[model samples]
Target: MSVFVTVVLFLVLAVAVNADIEVDCGHTEVKVRWSDPRSQMEPSLLKLGTCSPNSFYDGKAVFNVNLEDCSFRRMVTGGQVIFLNDLTHIYDPAFSQPVVCAFERHSDWSPPLYTPKFNTYGYSNLVFQMGLMNADFTGPALSSAYPLGSLIPIMAAVYQSSHQPLLLHMEECFAAMTPQPQPDSPVYPIITNKGCLVDSKSTNSRFQTRERTSEMHLLLQAFKFPLGEDVYIHCKLMAWDPEGLDSSKKACHFVKGHGWELLDDPARSDLCRCCDSHCMARRKRGLASGQGVMQKTVLGPLTIIDGSTP
Candidate 1:
């Protein structure tokens, strides 16, 4: 399962009051900084589970906690992986705020970003694979070479050898300069907001018809960024109920004048409307027991030749 925890933060660039705070979500940790410009907020007065404020700097009380520590509650829903916690204070008996952090599996080749909570029963046997595909989509692309502006067909599949009924969805995708994107790596958004193909808004990139519920396809247009070097594509793949198609869980693409349209079933394209804005995720009630809903895979080192160069 994949997960994103809601870390509520009250931020102001231009101005703010005494209770103002800022949050920063790292690859394997969550940081909360309470600004005390007036020296009104005391570090000892605040707490996150059993963790106390770790430091005081820049007139702020800082709490930096690991994702797995500080009494974090592990949760999973429909493939999202998440850890949750709450901040309690002696200052206000009724005041409480949630703290959350989440991370996805990058790939077998990449280093582990954070430890995931596995089911007490068993680990997910579900196998996922992604690769560059040939133009006809008949087989894997013989070469990972594409001229700028050319379409790069990417095929992602969940090998359901047991023939289990499963529907695969691309949750999010981004292009990076490195095959294994680090937390600090600069990235270009290709698909965002669950399955919205944001790159399609500017180019011909978009999702294609799926051959099976366990498979997803994307025709990504090559770009000139980083100019003649290789680009890597990373995507979060999800497996969900075949009938549980919701706005936050869909494959949508921009159609120029038609706005966003679903790839598999345009009849339910209304779900694609959320692609224009934020898609409200379902409330996380508990832990993802087994092979929850999501898996992130990598595809790349694909060469992009800028046609303008030669």
Candidate 2:
């Protein structure tokens, strides 16, 4: 009788274990639904205290869960955009156990207006390092899909990379501006006739002093409707490593030259000429004063063909 009772107890325990499921599907779905409060909150709860067909609302929140092999799919319904930052977590079986995951959504997604590609010449290579503020601009600019501001960080990076004294040769520069209406009437100015200078001189006796120079020309113009607004074009010639050089040491120097000039009569073989005689003159003087010759290095010019409206 004692042996019979022991076998019966083992059978009961096995049955109980089979009935217990680790995953609670209903509870998991409920948690996901609750985490997306934006979908459930009444329009009256909005800061405006009302919701309309055009009412826009955005919220950022996180949810943690454990799941396995999770993935997500998104679609637009009723002209509303919904972004599931981490769609995989919901489908992940691992999420069925208790774990933390993140979810974020925004009603407004501002796509880029214009993007430009960075052109390289000869054996030159382009290196880009974007600051936190302009990180969004790098990828789009390289693809030529986003506007001019998006390339600012890229420009900074390229300018910093040129081993020789650089110049902002504006003859090849291009600018694209989005023609959106603005309250401040801000204009995006284009750069024309820009170039950079790089000083390769070493101050210490252990290293040799060398001077290198390159020249380029490009056209820059601000994006403005009237095309005659008082637009300002700001250009900077910074050291490759400003911190590495002493403040008193000049890494590179820049000097502006004459603008576009008419080549006498149009009947002449040359219709027009843009000369940087002043730059050449300054370079000669520098060389005479112990600065080395200006070595020509090729950095591809960026050209802007048109403006955008988005």
Candidate 3:
């Protein structure tokens, strides 16, 4: 009977001590220790700190921990990560705020971190087919036609690469135009102000990524410009990392794309003119038109911040 009781107690103790454990690589508020075979044998070991010398090059850090473990796979597949045993807490105050985690795939080169990238293909029409005009007109006459009170849709889509998800918090966005007589000319006359016609309008507000990318669209019906003049269109966007907004580093990303296509009649220059305000509106209404996704550009590359780790 004593032996039976001892066996029961041992089983209970084993069950209590050896159980599957989860460590959220994305976010962890609790203390954790490494459960790998080596770390398990030496619970006190901390492995080498990720801050050790030569840890990062070209914005990517080589973490000493093996990412092939099931826990890592779980983290990539699912936001919440579960490890085999108690493990040392993984935390990088700079990167752990809201817990943004992403892994490298065999596909394209993954940026050091997950970031927003613009969809240039969707913007083709907005940049190329914005206006219709003849190429031969040269004098003071306007080469393009326009109807009053026309509205143009300016739009873009953004997505995070691979399967990693991201939540976007928009900060600011605007559309501007520069009118020039010739595409090669260095000087340009301003025809529109910031934000195009909706200077006070807000954007998508906020959005999260899924199997696909998120998008933003704007109706530009608020501009007063000379009819028949050719112009260049440019859009600039900025989004903030909600958790890192106050950081002095690159806490936000800026994306930009331009729409400028020279007509076949205009000597094939690189300038696209806007249709008369009312003309574009009637065209869309007539069609009842339905429509409707990159090299990842990093803000760090342009900013003074050195993303490389020492």
Candidate 4:
């Protein structure tokens, strides 16, 4: 009987895991229904009150909110856009406030920028980090050399991986590793938008750092020959600006020329296991890799009065 009970419990757990969750945001007139992409489930109740002046709404997969003045702001997986209206609300003070919000899936990565909120008057925090992945970080030093013809995926933690969370998009990206060890800089090949686009409002929403690690995965496999040298990885992160304004001028700084040792050993050897089969599979599929793998985990309707909390 105990064994049978255990089997029943396992089956129940499996079914629950496969079950889909839906979100329905409504008040009296407007209604928006959204279901989880992973499963096909029915809609459930999810009420969204007045969001704070500047905060992100994670209650629904895709949603649109009607402002106090009847104007609306829509948040969808495709992207986010704002529609301006002339007549602002006089009775409902919410409309006049500098309220800007985005609805995105939750993540473990730190916030993208360290600013007040996504839609604040002045919010700018753009930075990224890179590091090597070894089975044992405390064990003997590991080699960065990867086998020739194989792909090297260097994990990158952009804005969302920092303590500061700001709203920004991944305008551009590039990675380079030194083939031959030396002092003078070598011309490293440039790549763009290869992996995930680190953006707060994009479908690939950058999440809090404590929840996720390495928001971007960069693949390096441009070397034509297996040269014997120290492999150094350098990555650059740029901010995405939709309004066609200067990103740097707006404080959306770009990271460039920063280098990190990918593989420390002088030569490639058996001691080095610097390859990712899953990453290789992703490359083979060609684009659309990790589409929904790394998303923000929804806890509940989070009403953050202070958007500038570490």
Candidate 5:
């Protein structure tokens, strides 16, 4: 009788422990953990599966959610669903086709973090495609709505890579509901780096004038971002001429990159070396001429902050 009682108590404790689930979001990954008392010895049993004929646990079941599906927008509290179709106005045709996942409870959606309203001098066309752990999404199982608890991690990874600011346009969004930074507050810091330029010109007889010119290379990096929170990096470029003549105007260009992309490829070794080199060379020559030709540029990194499991 004592042995029977002990077994009952053990079963009860196991069930209690298995009911809780914890999710962790990292710079480049998301992890979901849960306990299952029914098959404590076989963790795989808790994974998504279908029930078999005449079996209690063998029925057709889906675990992941499609990020694009209307159902997902309804499930998430105060979540706003932005489809590729809606982004075409601000993005190019190539970008118009990529998938995007956005959730905000704010009354008004802010311009893109890197790309802001044109008058605001920010990049306005950055977008993201939904996938699983940087892998291609093959079906509904891998969609953002899937129950894999992987979304947070994936978001964190993207933020870590791009460091581009994430604007929580929704006031009541999950991140905003918590005591963390408010949607309108600038809680994170913006890092700045030096800009370089390159130029080639030849002196002419009876006439000396500068005509054709190009910009030099510029690079910037940012770090230490909160998980699941929006982040942004802003980069701008300014230039001047050899005769100590600054351009009558400054040309501003912005590129939108994500933290997850940075975390996924932190080394940034995948950048186009050939194009970068040309840009850098231009900056170097412009500076060497001592003619006053210089360029100033900025890069913005943004993402949201969230917690991770130890």
Candidate 6:
């Protein structure tokens, strides 16, 4: 009878220790830690929607997520906003009471509204504008809904009064859930390296040639993001001398049958090979550090009804 009682006590302690879940919330981030009493528990068992825990160490599941990321369910009531997320264990049958996190949106912070990136003297007297365009790349888009897998023509332009003769380059771009891209908001990369159409690496996205060099037509596709249904395109736009077309500055797209191709001059396609790995500047320049004619353009809240539910 004493041996039986000892076994029962150990099992009770094991269950109690394994079920402990702690949630820590900050202004912009949340950290979740779950203790594991069983040595056989795997990190894949715990999930935050489609996101896995950031790390698992020392018999503990450690999850770090931004408040605005992972599509935390948001609702408004009484002029206040609330965000909530529930955690689930994929394989744990006894985990009926899943851990949950809910918090009121901070009164001090909200998503910033974006305006047309017009002429800015600070950015080296450059006039910038970005928007969704028509299929022919002639003008702005007219429809509200776009079919899934269809092309999305996102155009960006720079108007310069003086003929400084600067070549435009898009270094990187990501699709977000909101108009104002924040530091912690979740994002999906569409372009990378100096100008690699990384999304085209998987989907049917590429750059269309326009007559004018100032304007660029990025042909993207409509899809449902893991974070949210809404999509925003934010890009880092830079202007450099045409003579200064270095590896750090390029426009490239991956062809289905072929490899990476440079948009401006296909002869120098070698410059974009770094897109497969990483793009590093030969030297640190003031422009790359944020002082040059570089600006971030946010275009979206783009209406994409990609998926429908009955």
Q: What is the C-alpha lDDT of each candidate?
A: 0.69, 0.24, 0.24, 0.27, 0.23, 0.66
Best by the TM-score measure: 6
Give the residue spans of candidate 2 off by over 4 A.
1-117, 123-189, 192-222, 225-281, 284-310
Worst lDDT window (10 residues) for model 6? 5-14
lDDT of 6 by residue, 130-161 (tens): 77778887767775346777888888777777
Comparing 2 with 6 on TM-score, the higher-scoring candidate is 6
lDDT of 6 at 294: 68
TM-score of 3: 0.23
Candidate 6 stretches with Cα past 4 Å from truth are: 1-122, 182-184, 226-228, 282-292, 307-310
Error of 1 at 86 (Å): 33
TM-score of 2: 0.21
Best by lDDT: 1
- Cα RMSD (angstroms) for every candidate in the order listed: 15.8, 24.7, 24.8, 22.7, 22.4, 17.3
* Rank order (by lDDT, best first): 1, 6, 4, 3, 2, 5
What are the runs in model 4 whose C-alpha is more than 4 Å off?
Answer: 1-127, 134-142, 159-185, 192-214, 239-310
How would you encode candidate 1's per-residue C-alpha lDDT over 1-310 as one tens digit per residue? 7965443323222211225566666656778877656645565667775467898666667788876555555544443455566676757767567765555532222222333221111115577777788897887787766888999888887765454477888889998876456799788999899889999999999888887888888899997678755576778877776777888778999998988898879988999888777988764221153223677666655678877665
lDDT for residue 212 in candidate 6, whole number 0-100: 75
TM-scores for the candidates? 0.57, 0.21, 0.23, 0.25, 0.21, 0.58
lDDT of 2 by residue, 1-310 (tens): 3522111100111111112111112212201211233344432222100001123234322222322112111223443322222222222323221212222223443222223333222112322221111334324234322243222233323333435443222221222222122456543333222221211011100101122223222212212233312111223322222122221112222222422322111132121221222222122223233222222221112223224543
Cα error of candidate 5 at position 86, Å: 12
Error of 5 at 231 (Å): 2.4
Better of 3 and 6 by TM-score: 6
Residue range 1-310, candidate 5, lDDT tens digits: 3522111100111111123333332221223343434422333223311111121222221123222221111112343423211111122233211222333434443322232111111111222221112222112222121111222211110111332232111000111211223567544322111211111011110111112222111111212345434333222333333232111222112233421111112244232222223222232233334322221111112243322432
